[model samples]
Target: MSETIIAKRYAQALFHIGQERSKLEEFESELRTLQEVLRNNQALYSFLQHPRITLDQKKQLVNESFQSFSKEVIHTLNLLLDRHREEILSAMVDQFLTLMNETKGIADAKVYSVRALSEGEKKRISKTFAPKVGKQTLNITNYVDRSLIGGLRVRIGNRIFDGSVSGKLDRIERELVSNK
Candidate 1:
């Protein structure tokens, strides 16, 4: 099976467990921290992937490093390590987060503006756009992009609502050229 398929399966199982235990948010946070560590530490990633290392040793290291994590998360890691599927850890976490967000009626959104947006601006954007995307609310992450010239762009999932000045100019230019 493809890595993504495997990851989704594992993620679904974990998501169910989280829901049953009423610890979905806790697991999501812990999983994100683990994913970040795996992403930022090449050596640790290699160590986990190394064939020479024993499973016990890898589990020991993982346990020591993530001692503060919940038992469910730690057990999941150990299970993955034992099965030699550690490489899919990040993907699993991402799928799990997606499931959690969907269950909570939340969507992750990216807001790009010429300048940093205030809390009020973010809230306004979320209120205006979240319903359009069939979500109750948006978890907005803002980015400052001077290239936008002015205004902002909002992306939720595969849809992008572009209100930037540059976007407007491009659309007008396209219409003018097409009319010729």
Candidate 2:
């Protein structure tokens, strides 16, 4: 299967496990901590990702590092690691969170602009979006892209709403050409 497929499958499995056990919140926190450790510590991440490392050694290392984890948490980690699918561990965790949020009817919106938005601006934009999205609840993520030149683009799920200056300029140019 494709990596994305594999990642999604793993994410779904974790989400189901969390939901069934009523430990979703705890699982989310633990996975985020694990992902953070992998992200912030280059050596540990490398050690975990190296293909040559035996599963036994990896399990030992993980056990040593996560001595405080409960039995369920350790079982979950060992199951994923034993699959030699550590590369997708972080993405799986992120996707799992996204799945949870989406299932809970919380929208994740992303606004990309040419410049940074102020706190007030974010609130205004989010307010504008919440109604349009047909949901009062939202989680907004922002990014700045100088190349966009002036306007903003908002995306939620598979839909992208673009009103950037560059986009408008292109539309104008296209209209002028079409009129000619």
lDDT of each: 0.93, 0.82
Put down candidate 2 lDDT per residue, 67-168, tens digits, no spaces: 876566677678878888877777776788788777776788899998788888888887888778776666778899887788899998887888998888
Residue 83 lDDT, candidate 1, scale 0-100: 88
Candidate 1 backbone clash number:
0
Best by lDDT: 1
Model 1 per-residue lDDT tens digits across residues 83-156: 89988988998999899899999999999999999999999999999999999999999999999999999999
- Cα RMSD for predicted model 1: 1.6
Q: Which clashing pairs does model 2 show?
A: none
